[model samples]
Target: MLRELRWLMAGALATTLAACSPGDTELLAPRATARAPGRATTQQENLQAFARVYGYVRWFHPTDAASRTDWRALAAIGVAQVRDAATLDELRTRLVELFGPLAPRLDLWIDGESTPAPGPTPQGRDTMVYWQHEGYVGTRLSLYAPPYGQVRVNAEGPHRRRFTQAPAPDARVEVELVPGLHLRLPTVLSPADAEHDGEAPLDDAGLAHAARSASGYHDLDVRQGAVIEVWNVFRHFYPYQDTVEIDWPGLLAQALADAENDRTVDDTAATLWTLVHALQDGHGMVGHREIAARGRLPVRVEMVDGVPTVTGTDDPSHFAIGDVIEAVDGVALAPRVAHLADRLSGSPQWRRFRAASWESLTGPRDAAATVKLRRGRRALEVDAHFNASEPAQPPRPPQLHRFDDGTYYVDLTRAQYEDLEPALPEIAAAPAVVFDMRGYPSNTHKILAHLLREEENADWMHVPQVLAPDGHIVGWDPIGWHVRPAEPHVQGKLTFLIDAEAISYAESILGYVEAHDLGTLVGTPSAGANGDIVRVDTLGGFFVIFTGMKVTRHDGSRFHVEGVQPKVAAAPTLAGLAAGRDEVLEAGLANARTP
Candidate 1:
């Protein structure tokens, strides 16, 4: 009856394990006891069983399983069962009955069975445990560490710092917390021997064992290949290092660790994004199609009067326009915005623009968000569900607006500069022209060409060329864009309407207009990330987009971080928004009439 009970429990365990995805299991290196090729003792057999059972539970069970089952207690019972078995076959049968069908996934090899070749391990004598906790990174001696030992910790982020410790026999040293974007803990020690090699070189049998160990898991080979390729490509072509402040070695180490433990492509993509954002390059992005079309919250939150308020909503039943959000997922709105800002790449202005919206905080459809909001001084907490439906079409700005005062308004977001070819005659006839550059333009050169008066001065843009992998700027190719002598160009006063949304190509044009005194810029600062983008693909089917070219004005001043400065800085007031008044556009129109 006891034997039958054991079999019943084992079969139940198999059913539960089967429900999990193959990638959900924790992976372990193959371990074969180094002993003579003879019959194993009961004690030895039980120890081997204990190792396998421990590994199986750690990888296969839910992270919060301790509350559900006393895992250690189950392993103790299994160990006793193996020890009491009379023979090797009896021990194997006992393990098989205890673990059921899931026994094979553990990759455990008992005594006398060929052990797998050991993989590489970090060299050290002390036991080290490295982890990231609550935005802090640190390392300490593992619980299994020796009473007295030396520990050295190296942390790399925006800066570098090293800490060495000679701890008291009983107390572990507390590391001083220094803020950084990323952290690394090097010199993890092995408790066995300080000089002892952690892994032995593997033979063909070991290689086969490794492959078998990874059979059911995601293709680690492909992920590692992608990591290597990204490392190589970034080293060769990346042009802007001064703007990118990151610890590459530390980040790559974390990335490799993620590749080993990541369960899905989304998991890997998030890890890669964290690395890409470290550069603070606005073009830096890492994702796939699935991530691109991922669901968003059905509301748009805008920064109004320095407060995050619901400016629009797709689902009016759950949220209302004008509702001010106070917190997200129990975290205060300020801290949440700060945390999200860390995930984005750009200047402080650009980061604010990217993270100011509720869409930036949304995740997949199943990811429910808890939001605390205030409406007319009444505060309430609501569980907001994500919208799986396609997003509604955004309102398109007017292509061109003609005023009764003979002033022409050209919306750069909707109308390309080439679209202005037919309107040039009308533009030249007008007293003043307002180029609505509140958003990005399709082509910067096409619009800026009309503003240049001289042929030699037409060449205003310079792009960096890569000749070597050493990261030093090799050469610069000056690009010339000449305007046609069609109808004598617009000789009237020109005013550009720009704001935080004006970015990339828009800023490119703004820089040109500012350089040659071509036009007066009005409104808020532009998004600081500029230049062309370079896209890279990894073996794991993830793609990263980063700034590939270095863009500067004719005067050699940088457009990165230091965006186009407007002559008339203005933004919309809360009252203005409530009244549906375009304050920035009014400011631009005022500038157009300035003497």
Candidate 2:
């Protein structure tokens, strides 16, 4: 009944509000109340049910995705969840059960510290609602960092900003899991507050200085942290063939210093992010894993021809549509986008990734924003309105191409497994096969399950874990798991078409193809931002991804961060895409023709 109710609420909310603007102030229509929680859910008793899933993934979870947790990660998840929730009661009960009582991580002292503080009452009498599960977490980013700092966040893939709220902050926000059920940490100061508390925010010049300092240590690679170490250690029993040099002692020292810094958590987070970014790998990352984890502005928007166009907001009473968005907070989106594009341009196959990632955020991708706009040369403040986009048109679904030489090329999307799986036996009869796994799995687990299982797995089980800077693996278990598919297709010379985008579960796909010898893996080194991949549900600027475990591969090793390397590599470019060239696929085809 409890499970059903949870689903009912989630589904009801989704279905009821899918088309409604998140900024809409219309109260959700109330229904006949279920029996009071004390009478109904109270009987089902167990504090575990109400807590955020972070703890489950921290200790008992398996895969090396959500690498580790420091105070920021722990506190962020707790506060972030309640902030995203739809009701205050649900927030209160959940908070009480988690930080108040059933806190799995008791050492952080969350249970006692998360007590109620007074706030304005319904009638403005100044009494706080002790439990507000839903309303507490809803897009109001109750957490964030100082300005001018960066954060190192690891995720399996990028997220879509079509349906949620604005972003929290541009400053760094570092997080990682530690061993044990540690208690919650307190919310520290954001930039404005931090500066008020005698902390100075880093500026562009400061970033350059910090970057230079970190370069003496490790080049800033986004995929440098989180589950990467676990993958490095477990996947190869110490990869790199030689003893890779890591600042183990330095890592431990830093984690402690970060947690107790006088500079403030947000400032500290920003500093850590700068260091992580210095690693200089596409896969390496340092920032919020989930969009809902932070605060955001009030605007709805979309990118039109590389320009931010505001469409709507909750209170158009302040700012509305037709405004051209130029900046967020104080940072210009165009400059950031340009900077990222410049960084991406240096990659071996810059064109494809640059194009894909850029287009991913460009025109027509639904956007909600709080912004500074310039329309007809007049600057204005506006909240952009958003609407779901029609499915992107250019990457037209591929049609299967059958070659007369017993080689078959079946166009595949990560989600289109059922389309090709049934024809696998026919494919096995062929001499060569190609699987294009350039994207993450889109279909629910059912299709992926069928393609991956060698023997039908009755119970779907996988674990998610985070590796700390010191290399300790922390874990969690996702609650809902589907059955694994029992059948796997031909073990022939399969060549997979991968790019920077194939990360997380998609990166795990590389392990499966390589380990099972389903084919010769071909592509560039992945973007490497693997782990408990975050996704679209984040309300504010928080990248709220799937903070749970994913279905793993055979050896129980599901390291997502460092990404799978291509057996042969090719990089893409904007110029190349315009010419209708797929260098990676061509190279893959060349690799497959080994006579």
Q: Compose the digit string of candidate 2's lDDT tens values, residues 1-595.
A: 3322221121111001111122321233332333222222220112222222333322211122222323122332343234333332353344443332222111221111221221111221121111101011112222441111111121122222211222212111112111111122111112222121111112233322322232211212111221222122222111111222445334323432332332332333333433233232333333333211333334433333455444334445654444555766567776655555443312333323433233223322245655676755577776543333222222323545656676767555533656666676776566777767776654423433434545432222233232221122223333223345555545345687886656555654555555555566776666454333222111111121221233334454443334566777765443343355565677777776765
What local lDDT score does residue 301 receive in model 2, on the 0 to 100 scale? 37
160, model 1: CA deviation in Å?
43
Worst 10 residues of 2 by lDDT: 127-136
**Every candidate's lDDT:** 0.52, 0.36
The alpha-carbon RMSD values of the candidates against the true structure, listed in the order shown, are 18.9, 22.3
- Which residue pairs clash in candidate 1? 126-189
TM-score of 1: 0.57
| Least accurate 10 contiguous residues by lDDT in model 1 | 176-185
* Residue-pair clashes per candidate: 1, 106
**What's the distance in Å from true for residue 441, model 1?**
1.9
